[model samples]
Target: MMPHQPSQWICAGRFPPPYDGQSLLTQELLELLSPEFSFIRADATARPPEGRIYAPGRLRLRRIPEMFRYIHHLRWLTTRYPLPILYAIFSGNPLGHIRDCVTFAWAIPRRRPVVVWTHNALLSLHASPLWHRTLHWLTRRATLFVFAGRSLYEPLRDILPEEQIAIIPNLVRRALLCSQTEVERKLAHADVSSRLRLLFVGHMLPEKGGWQLLEAAFLLRRHGVPFQLTYVGGWVTSHDASAFTRRIAELGLSRQIVHHGSIRDPETLRQLYLSHHLFLLPTKHPTEAQPTSILEALNAGCAVIGTPHATLPEIIQPGVNGFLVLQHPREIAEAIAHYWHNPNLWYSHARAARQLFVERFHPDRIRQQWIELLRRVQQSIPELAQVTT
Candidate 1:
């Protein structure tokens, strides 16, 4: 489809230059779903619904005015397109979802076919009675609703008609995926190693289990375990960095830890995921849906150790591909030790992780799911399938 073409499908969601998961996924679908439906993007980039680490600093303050400006323009922009079938990506922040809400509200009178794709599972799952009521009212306006998993949308089965909901997991780009053989080899543990390469790749926020991961590293060192913990990604705040540094020093873990602040290169990031033996993200963040990083790590065939929060339990089968534990340093240390002492166990889990990724998260399967969804929406709402003269 050429640019400026008045397409039947209007995809109004976050789009990337920022490289956040939601935007990247949105961008992928826009590309993949194009042949089936001529497309125009209604991007909410002016402070997207996800990413852009809102640090407790001047930069965050600077984003306030610009955010409103973008939303206002987006409201005006939506009117330009004939949205016979609208697909809007939402990650469940009431504030971030404001523009989409406005767009939905404005189109209520016209009653166009709208499909809301929700990323964060717990938002609707854990809402107050008032919030649930609000969502029911809004969702009833749409022809279809899409979520990542059954566990995510199961609770809404009563509120949303079963036929109206579809569960489609997120997809990983094929290029980023390492071959299964390469992944297994890279994740293979030597019969014996002096040091185990452990990794934690996310924000430095306490809720993200950064403190717990560092403390686990300290405990492992205290036990005289030969392991090196590599901490990657930028600290969300200078204070987070400072406190992390102070904790490492206090625990005498300075030399054993390598803090790679904000790795921008795709190759380097891929190398980190592929090289690391264990990907540790024992996050307790309640709002987390299934994290794209977990899929990425599994794609690289790294054994995972994650807290069973939100949709993580559905993704991680404890003792199969990964260990699900509470955010306790001692428990985390023990899980790592199990893999360390049992190298065979590590290799088995590594293979399992890759298989899990292929069976569930691969783009080929995800693309098929999206195509079915598009067809379902079109067939169910015949007006959407009609071509403009």
Candidate 2:
């Protein structure tokens, strides 16, 4: 598919802190694609910069107000730009889904192609049957549907045609791709006596498998495994915070496990990844489609450990790039111990993981895939041209 210069592309979704995988991806996409395309953004968080305007306010408001704000933003865009391509990154929350639906409804009349980027499989599944039918109808009317992983493709396959669904993996920044040599050098510099430095970079939520990880850490420690577990990312809910802290105390992993809270800055995150020996995200959430942290870990040349849920299998080739354990904390501990005891195995897996990141999660490669998908969608839906032309 030949890439045509889009007059403008308006990325409408919740962005950055409130830090989510989708929001980070949106920001990365804008950074990479803006040089070539006239980019405008509409975020549910803060009002974007003057030229690329974003709707103000966090997305925790009432349904009516959110809808009104979204509609107002859409109306503003229509008036400002020649019906630009609407890239809507859907959220799993009820209000977010409603906002997406409203955005789709608004786009239909304008005949602008709507690109629905989803990170959750159940986003299509858990909706009302009527809503699903309506979504299918709207999907057929849409120009494209982008998913973070192929795991999400099956449920929505019946709605949008296979051709319209683009499976573009989550991408990480080029700087995040630390070479094995660099990682080794950093690890040497950190100079921890422990053979393994396991790091978990996500929220301290149960759904994120924080408690499970702490349990696993305790088990590993009891068995005399020499390793450290560092938990990054802030606690979103109070329950998540309290549960995580309590578990840490209960497990007596105070010395072995440390909560670094949230590290929002990208450079700092990269430094954390570089300093770590392994990355573990035991996310058991059914809603988690693809985690950028895993990709970031892989990119940083760290051996990864994840649960066999969501897109973990897709990213981590067990015994090859990383390990994928069941929900059992014992199993997680065993896997951690396996990597901890064997430096050669750890290095090999770490190298393979970084290679996987280069091939699958590099920003330029993924961005090209996105461009190709957009081109295909534009060609299939002639109405898209009508809006931009």
Candidate 3:
């Protein structure tokens, strides 16, 4: 066992066994940081661990009750720990926003250093001016503000001091990197004789461009281009599922498209990446901070194609590691055809993509950055060191 550092940290965030980005990130942080820190996790949607329950699921009864319970819990935890820092990984839900505000306000009185992990692009969200003001106020009071992408860092740098804002991009494990020789061997055996294998790995929401990707696939088929497309994630909403299914049928793409619904296991996800030749995600949402799917694909050595939205441009260099396209389906189809004509482009780009992942987005490399940020927060709060040790 690794020697535990004397500092104790209570991680308040959304955590698995629920499959979402926030949950995955929280779990990853716990796994990487627990060896050095005495960590306790408090999940929003999960049952409390044994001996940590402040109350039952009574918070689900009403909004006011939930608010009350949240405040009570925040006060109790801070009072009990009285530690130097409280790191919160918050989503953009209304309830969560309020809870974060309350917790930050309470922490301020105790002089506890607070760190807020932002997964969403807050300024891009269609929030009311009042809500924006509240967010600004809360962020100004935080000891450190951590962003998953540089795009987010630009907008928030002025709100917090330069040193207080940390840009730690999401990462993929090193084991996911497959050798080019291995990828080629698997492709040869898969019998993809006539068609290029294109994979889309995200939810079926409109913002994720499910409709756009499906349309591009149809256009490719119409142009007599030989390619197969597979989608490998669940629907975001009921309406999204209905619309996606209707579009797939209307376009007569049943023969060219395979919809492989949610695959959660890490091993299975890596296998999907290895089996596919290209990964496409033309997400239209400007508020999207960063998508882990892109990193996972790069780690698996797949040639990537996505829109130049949010942090995508920071990750993908056009015509280098991958191609970035406009929102038009025709443009996407054209890019696909270009790659089909020059298969070596895919090999070269895939190699570059994997090299980039190893250089910056590897889990072990990024985890050190996170530890350094936590240590800075500790230094800012001298009282926390006394309580935690």
lDDT of 3: 0.71
The global C-alpha lDDT for each of the candidates, from Candidate 1 onward, is: 0.71, 0.70, 0.71
For this target, which candidate reaches the highest TM-score against the unseen true structure? Answer: 1
Q: How does candidate 3 fare on TM-score?
A: 0.86
Error of 1 at 30 (Å): 2.2
The TM-score between candidate 1 and the true structure equals 0.88
State TM-scores per candidate: 0.88, 0.86, 0.86
**Mind giving the per-residue lDDT tens digits that candidate 2 earns over 1-389?**
22334545776766675555567777777777655555566766542322122222235344466557766886677556654454656655444566667766664344656777775555534456646765666676667778888877766666667877788887786556666687668645643336578898865556777778778888888888888888886655556567777778887877887777766577888888997888988887746888888998988888888988888889989999888888779988998888656666777887798788877787878888877766666566566655443
Tens digit of lDDT per residue, candidate 3, span 61-99? Answer: 445664556556656666666554445555454545666
Model 3 stretches with alpha carbons more than 4 Å out: 1-5, 46-71, 84-86, 92-96, 106-110, 125-128, 173-193
- How does residue 278 of candidate 2 score in lDDT? 83
